[model samples]
Target chain A: MQEELFAPGHRGCAGCGAAIAARLILKGSGKDVIIVSPTGCLEVISSPYPESAWKVPWIHSLFENAAAVASGVEVALKSLGRKDEAKVIVIGGDGATIDIGIGALSGMLERGHDITYICYDNEAYMNTGIQRSSSTPYGASTTTSPAGKVSFGENRPKKNLPAIAAAHGIPYVATASIAYPKDVIKKVKKAISIEGPKYLQIHAPCCTGWGFDGSKTIEIGRLAVETALFPIYESTEGKVTSVKKVKRKPVEEYLKAQRRFSHLFKIEGGEEELKKIQDIADSNAKQFGLDQ
Target chain B: MEIMEGSRAVAEAVKACRPNVIAAYPITPQTHIVEEIARMVADGELASEYVRVDSEHSAMSVCVGASATGARTYTATTSQGMALMHEVLFNAAGLRLPIVMTAANRSLSAPINIWNDQQDTVSERDSGWIQLYAEDTQEASDMIIQAYKIAEDHDILLPVMVGMDGFILTHVHEPVELCPQEKVDDFLPSYDPAYYLTPKNPLSFGTIVYPSTYTEFRYMIHEAMKRAERKIIDVASDFRDKFGRHYGGLIDTYEAEDAEVLIMAMGSVIGTAKDAVDELRSDGKKVGIVKVRCYRPFPAEAISEAVKNAKAIAVLDKNISLGYEGALYTDVKSALYNENGPLALGFILGLGGRDITKNTIKSIAEKAQKAIKSGRVEKDSEFVDVGVL
Candidate 1:
């Protein structure tokens, strides 16, 4: 077996999808990489002064500057005549990617830095106790966007970060899920192999925040892909090159497994809300050709 | 000596330091300095990687990353740009990256003025970076090289901010003797960090410190700043030995001994104050000047010793603390707290591009003399040279 760069003593919760993504990412990139993490769950859990689970070089600076930090590391290596030493990678959460850090991320992609930025999308601000983030799925209830008499949980659709990343005309962009560990590793390898900036958004479910059974993390992640609520695909130079085709599962299969969406089944006009969420899944399927 | 723009002189000094990476975002008054460095990088005169960042926050973040990776790094900004970089500044210092930045001092906004003032960097006094002020183009250029030596010292390993007044020093043209590259290379060697981000060593940086150890880390930074005071003086002495130029270590004095009155100030205002002191001495008024070169690691001991025998001391501040007195005035009072020291008074003037003339300093000195004769101060801190609308 390969040397485990992500050691076993981290403080991540049981069945944490982000922890699985972190282990698999290091496995794919090997030990010849420097990880730049922003302020998020993975950084806080993996590193807590005088102790770290990372057996490789890792740095956690702030919430909104991981891409900028990675750019500096990549250029510093080239300037020091050690460009072949290691690949630079950034592992940030969704709040650090689609929300506060989007400006720096866009700047990095525009500059064409030789770095791979992977954002583990846990949907909400899990580190800050399930606050609503731009990446929160539609009709899902979080602490900040609690469903009630006047509100329908998160009223807006998720931010299309992968498309925004590809719009920068980057070399590669892909989406993966922690349930498919092999695919996650494969995409990480391909991203590092590319010469310019590449972005990958991995759907990593949160068991605690999503109100699901700890053992059901991978099961729910697979449901997200199979139901077409979250499409898994690859785009190269702004064109869709490959996608994970699925025999379409009902959206209810994915929603019923998590308590965040359980309110919809009990609410007064929740069937109409359920139909709206189904339409969102249908839109994703049509756009990515996920139901081949 | 060759006549060069202050910005060009600074760029020349940075080239001599041989930094591995330079990241900067342009703002008013600071644009000329970075532009010259960028041009040199383009012309093949300097072989450093110049990353043009999108904002000042990223500019500092880029420096933090590069410096953590065992590379010498540099950046420059001012005023609102420095305000934008407040969070990253603390992070860089906490990580002990030893990055050097040029803060071309400019006034803060609300009225939105892009003119010369010391409020920008002064606002960041507690961010754990050594703060140095420059009185002229030559001193500003020379301090950049010295800043790197002081910051990269293993005993120190703290970031440094070399502050020069915007438009006053940044835009002025002066005859500056540019140090030869070989001499600078000898005085300041290549950066050899004890710890850095490298896959070969596999170390982590900027870890989250819990309550049990966070205070210890902060205390260590405080101790490092205390040690940096001595390093700053030693580096300046060595620089003077090699280059035949010396600005005093923490505080530079002019005719300060055996004087009845003393004036204290920093940055370009010191030049005007020096002329004012010369006039006062020739008139047999028994006055002198104390120029504060290093503002942080506040030279309280040196300041108290310098003004010990004097009856009254006047402090001129280009920046104010809004509701309170001038920041320097407050610090000067604190320095003189335990001693039977001079009756120190503060005068706020020359803010937001307002000129500080010789006459202004002479009048401030006259006010100090009056307080000495009265044996007490009428007003503690007063704003000088405010014309009624």
Candidate 2:
């Protein structure tokens, strides 16, 4: 077995999907990688001074600027005449990637830097007490977008972060989930091989933030893909190259799996709200040919 | 030596420093320096990675990354661009990376004016970065070289902000001696960072520090700044041995050695103040100039030593502390806490690009004369250039 670049002892919550994705990412990256993380659950949990779960060269600065920092590391390596031997990877949560940090990410991609940018999309700012982020899917209840008497949770669709990166005409862009570890590893390896900017958005199901059974983390992630709620796909130069086909289960199956969405089942007009979620899944299936 | 724009001279000096990476984002009055650097990179005069980042925030972030990897890095921005970089500025210093920046000091907005002022860099006084102000275009060019040396000193591994007056110094053409690459090479060796981001070495940078260890890390930066006072002077002495000109150590003095009334200021206005002091001296007045070159690491001891004998000290500040007095006026007063010294008056002037004539300095000297005769001043601080209501 390959050595764990992300060591075993970490403060990550039990069955944290981000921790699993981080492990899989480190495994694919192997030893010749420098990781830059923005402020998030993974950063706080892995780094607490006296110990660090990162066995690789890693840095976590602010909530944003991971992509820009990665660009610096890449450019510095290239300048030092060692660009080929190492790879720069920026890992940040959805809030940092899709929202606050998108400008820096866009700059890095458009400048055509040779780096891999990873966004572990956990929907909300899990490290900051579950505040809603732009990546929060419509109808999901977060602390900030709590399902009060007259309100549904986040009132917007999840920001299409992968598509945003692909539109930069980068060399590679892919979406994966922790449920498919092998697939995640394969896509990451592919991204590292490419010469220019590559982006990966992983569906990281946070058990603590999403109020799910810790042991059912992988099961919840699989249901998300099966329902077409989190379509897994690869795009090259703005063109969708391939997608993981789904059997197209109702979104209710995915929603029923997490307590963050328990309100839609327990409240009045709950069925109607559940139907709206199904419409979103149906849209993703039709748009990405995920049902084919 | 050739006549060059202040920005071009700085660009040539940066090339001499041989930075491995430069992140460029244009802000007015700072655009010329970055443009020249870009041209140098394209024409093969400088072999460096010129990263064209989108905003000042990304510019600083890239520098933070490049510096962490032990690469000598450079960037230039002004006013609003500097404000955009506020968040990363702390990160850069707290990480103890020696990234050097040229902040073409310009006034901040509200009515949105783009002209020379010290307020932008002064507002970032507590960001833990060393702040240096230049008195002229030539000093602006020379200080960029000094900044890299002082910042990267292992004893003082902190980011340095080199401030030159917007349009006044940055846009003005002056004869500046562009130090040869060989001399700069001898002065600045290849940067060898004790800590860096490398896959082979495998270490973490900017990791989360609990409250238990955070204060100690911050204390390290404070200690570095305390140590920088000596390092800044040492680098200047070393720089002077190689290059024939000396841009004073910390605070540059002009005839303050034998004067009763001392006038003080930073940035290009000090150049004008010097000219005014010379004119006042010819008229049999004991007025002199104390050009503030290094603003942060506030140089309190240097200020005390320079103004000890002066009967009264007048500080012409381009930046006001709003409800309080001028920023430097406050620092100078605090430095005199345990010593008997001059009755210093703070005069706020030339804000938002209003011109600072030699006569403005004379008017300030007159104010000091009145305060010196009475051994008291009418007010703590007052504006000299804002039109009367």
Candidate 3:
């Protein structure tokens, strides 16, 4: 009805998946919201001081404590008797959500605060240069986890943040992607309307860190969803009730677009690595009943 | 109106402060502070939001949010609870919100003992907060009032921590003159946060910053802390003028002039040191005491001057720096290095619930005096009274 809350002039790179994810989230949340963002690319680029691209009330706190900070905002508002005045939202990169900030996030979730936490999963720590994060998919090459002669790129499976959120038994928890713009917005809107802690992890491809064509951000996101690499679903109180499933496409369709996985195709690792990624997706699909 | 325990005095002061929100979890010695506040809120003695936060981290978080929304806020925690809040503590300071907190000083965990000590407050020294150490219940009550003033001051908008040594002062009841709400209101104006979550003016705080200017934002916090140094002195002076009790800036000295031996301490242990000084004085020992009221904005100038004339200085630290020396020992040694005055003795005492008895204090003073005379500083600081199995 009104112009989307995520205005233009944000310094996110051209076609950056996380930027697009942020914009999609803003569109879903609308303008009457206070956003608490953790220190990451979105915060750094959108708010460079003197001027900020965010048209909404936003706060950028430290990296490992955005959820805790958001809880503070919630407490402060509730104390001031302003809880219904505006919705409180938290946005951060994968590192902030999955690694360093996990404890803070757990505390917020355990408290059952009324807020929406959005994780723009760009795979690696793109803001501080492309270091490998726990969420970086197995066999993906990052600056910290280089693909060399006797080793696969990153050796660990991606952290299951959705499952972790579900374990908290929060009111609402979902996983979306930047590729499905309308769907991401729809899920985010649903999350905001929920009473207590709501979490949404959106799959956002990193163009710079992953070495991809900046113009193909949406296309990569779409491929990620179609190939079952990133599924869209929602869980309430640890019970999965709804999912957005699609016809499975080859993993190559998702991997070929990014150079971080380029080694898997070029070296002797592609098939094995692809199998590992497919296994992860397959397990997720089965757990959430995404394949109908 | 009547004599109250230090914890109860702090609790009453917070109640009268009229905080819109009070969120804190209870720990030993610190439990009574929050329990009283909660009871007051529940009985309608105070109209406030009292949150039984799961942890100290959540308690601080709730206060941060409430403060950002233009509500005056307060919380209390000690020892492990304080350590758990290390992350949020930095956030509150960086945001420049005037949320007041009371920390009942106690040692940290790992042979966890819930008793009186300064380890808890001392460990958080570098978190960019205005730290004040109180000697007695009256000072504790008065400091809470002034802490709000100093923290909410426009030039020094930062979180302020009021420290009372756990069981020693927190649970110890004493006479404290309660400042009427009218006086408190005059001393501390209604909190008008510079930045807040208001609809009339839509603004973003804590916005992300690029390397091009991120350093400057952090430096701004440092600048505000430095500004707090001068503001603290002015506020304390004004408070003394109004209340007739002088806290004497960041550093408060007691009978230091013309004394050859200077015993320096902080928190309620200064009370023990003062009694020790009295005993030594009656025996005609040239000894005096200096209490560090403000721990951060470290009071370097005031400390140097306090110990300038003393030939022997013994600094008592309630916290160990682990593998190094005590926290205050390092800071005091560094502060006195340029003056080349006082053969300094570092004594780590009352760590993890060990009581600092008058006899213990006298022994320390005697040892320190002998060390000064012999010119042999006790480089290996003692972790006083820690037992072995």
Candidate 4:
């Protein structure tokens, strides 16, 4: 592995989840990799050229076409007969991966191309100033999902993307978090080694959008996995292979650390909201077999 | 060595140039080009990755990915297909990938005319691509070969558009001198993108730009385009030196000397206009023509010089702006304005897939020549053929 593919002088804000995810991904994929990034925070801050944090070859196309661009890289390598020599990886925000770029990713996967798609889900569209995204969690407060008198933040649950990618029957699909660098890097390495299309969803919490301590980026992400709000698991061709069933903690341990959910605590009858959050976490735990 | 349609000629040229990746969808007029290439690939005549994308948008997207990964890529499309791939087109240009595509010029919606016209390519003029309009099959075949070399030039890394008229040039069979594989190989070097997505050089692409840095990035793109103007000419000159063919960059002139009036046109209309000029010359009428090759770069200087000595100039456009004059008319008018030159006239002709006959050109020349001799402006700028309608 190259010592520092994504060098240290990046301008990512404190506790920036996407930045951490990028570092782990680079470390996991090692030195021989091409990265296709969609328009997002990590892309904006890391590359303000003529000074870039990346030490390797990188390309930034558009907001909704990272997967397609990565596919181009794959085909180019195939033409050069270098598919085995270099791995092609596409990294984008959840908004770009699950929403705008979904069709391209689906087509690429259906075509059974040699590529890996890594989506760093920060929940909302943070780069555009905390706007609501399809991946924004239920009861999350964004600019568009304000917690007004009658509103309880977001009304929709986070879109289940891994399940969707798994439905494609791709060779590998997994979910990881920036909190666990080893876990995220391991999954990335596994996906890269796979022959066919692979997908990875990395949970990276945003400090500015989630109203959490910027320094708590890693700790909060760990709590997300530990509290069972976010599960760490991998699947191959619609079949579950492995899952990280950690020692579970109370859901409040995860919620109390973030300011975006602080309103739920401030309101009267806060116990009901807390119960709903717990119910959601319990369902995820039972579904993914995260609870022993 | 055999005669072929413009589409087949382009396909043959593409085969000779040897693209590593070909991704495209079937669209009218443009379909035959991709179909022929697919057949060649299937027959093992061309060694490439032929991707049959679900849509035009995907076709371009796949091409972008393939090209970025270090493959020589190609595709072709018509009106609606070009419009559908609009989003990816800008990306290809902005990323500065040397992608070569053939756009069979056709009319836009809502009537949905898929005949010969320039509306499709003109709509994408500002897409930051090297736009070239071919006068015939030979030019179409030849321009593509030059396009690859010009686009891949380190100083001018931009996508190139080689446009032929739908149904007219794309469908009609004509005798085009096909360049042999060795000649083409010698002419066009393998595509080597300046910036590639390679593992040895791990880098993050597509960063979000703030207002403070946005202007500078756009300025760099602009500067690259300005640099392309010189590089295109140099590439064309190099092609002429090596292949014994010349595009002369920006614009190609025909019989402009000692002429009272000049007809400015683009695409296949240049062929018709040239024939009309020769016939009129035999009839003792002083008429010549100037064909616009590079529309995006506008070629303001070339057009100005070609029409400077003429008493009158008429600009022909196959696209109408609706409630206003044609797109080319505005550009040509601005190029000739207050230049101490002849009066420039705007003629909205052959739009909506209307055919531009030699008689139409002869009549336009007669009327324009009379206006120039009289030293008086015509009653109208737009000269529509009501007689034909």
True interface contacts reproduced, per candidate: 0.71, 0.81, 0.63, 0.74
TM-score for candidate 4? 0.92
If scored against the real structure, what TM-score would every candidate get?
0.99, 0.99, 0.89, 0.92
lDDT of 4 by residue, A133-184 (tens): 9898877778999887888888888888899999999999999999888888
Sorted by DockQ, highest first, which candidate order results? 2, 1, 4, 3
The candidates' DockQ values read 0.83, 0.86, 0.44, 0.51
User: B27-103, model 2: which lDDT tens digit per residue?
Assistant: 89899999999999999999999999989999999999989988999999989999999989999999999999999
lDDT by residue (A1-292, candidate 2, tens digit) is 2788888889998899999999999889888999999999999899889799999999887888999998899999999887876789988899999989999999999999999999998999999999999999989999999999998788889889898898899889999999999999999999999899999999999999988889999999999999999999999999999999988888888888888898999889888888888999989999999985
The TM-scores of chain A alone, one per candidate, are 0.99, 0.98, 0.96, 0.97
Task: Report the lDDT tens digits of candidate 1 across residue range B6-94.
Answer: 99899999999999999989999999999999999999999999998989999998898888888899999999999999999999999
Top lDDT prediction, candidate number: 1
TM-score of chain B of 3: 0.96
Q: Who wins the DockQ comparison?
A: 2
Evaluate model 2 with DockQ and give the value: 0.86
Docking class of 3: acceptable
CAPRI docking class of candidate 2: high
Question: 3 or 4, which is superior by DockQ?
Answer: 4
Ranking 1 against 4 by DockQ, winner = 1
Clashes of 2: 0
- Error of model 4, residue B21, in angstroms: 2.0
Q: Which regions of candidate 1 fall more than 4 Å away from where they truly are? A: B387-389
What interface RMSD, in Å and to 1 decimal, does model 3 have? Answer: 2.4
